[model samples]
Target: MAVRISKILLVASIGALLLLIALDNVFDYNTNYEIVSHVMSMDEVPRDSVISWRSITNPTLHKLLYGFIIFTEFAAAALCLAGAGKLWRERRAEAVRFNAAKNIAVAGLALGLGLYLFGFLGVGGEWFQMWRSATYNMQQAAFRFIGSIGLVLLFVHQRDD
Candidate 1:
């Protein structure tokens, strides 16, 4: 029971974190938009680098990408919150039922993992060379998010028996 409660709380916490992040991005649009813009533009990378060709100089594309990120964050948060609620309602159910309640939470966590790992790290860090930008680098933060969310995901997926 304690473990189940812990899982529920952890999922809820992740949901809250994602929700706050999405809200922050919306409320303080320019702050994060700058980061995204810089990363996509690749202007911060070495001037002589050949990969500069991959840079996306279009402002409209930047806005669209940023919007997609926020949408994904909000979707993950909603899924996590709903999953936590489902877990809470089934906390006292039999092992099978409790385990079944984890489906939504797992989906949410997976979505978060995809966002941080593939979206930020893969696309931003590798493809866009965001890691080269001292001011715009988000690799560390994205790594932290991936690690924490991955851990919670693993714990939550454990069988409830």
Candidate 2:
């Protein structure tokens, strides 16, 4: 039962991570404004009206970017689950538990590496895009830090009955 749950979560997490990468690479400058205008009840401009980057830039992307981060973080959380499951199943076998934890920690680090690459390589636009791009970069940095800490904790707290 527990193993089944772990498998489900693991697969879901992997899917979410992949989707987040795809969204992070997406650059739809025009659609963003239309969505924002609809959601926030902003008045539409005349066809010839010139909109500043600040005006057209969808500050609403903040939510979208945060969502991407959460999805990746959830995947990392799944890695922790995989490690914990191994430890739980082989509580009496210290070597087995340690090996399981080490392996999952490595996997978590690899997932973080992928997230970093996605964020780093995906951003390309004018200054209007810079705000979200910068935010995503910071998010990638923070996730990398968290991934490092999570792996360190797994190694530090490895134990057996």
**Per-model RMSD to reference:** 0.7, 10.8
> What's the lDDT for all of these models?
0.96, 0.44
* Predicted structure with the largest TM-score when compared to the true one: 1
RMSD of 1: 0.7
Candidate 1, 28-122: lDDT as tens digits: 99999999999999988887898889999899999999999999999999999999999999999999999999999999999998999999999
Query: Scored by Cα lDDT, where does model 1 land?
Result: 0.96
Alpha-carbon TM-score of each model against the true structure:
0.98, 0.36
* Model 1 CA deviation exceeding 4 Å by range: none
Clashing pairs in 1: none
lDDT of 2 by residue, 18-115 (tens): 44543543444344334323322222332343433233335566456545655665676566456546544554445544444446645654565555
Model 1 worst lDDT window (10 residues): 43-52
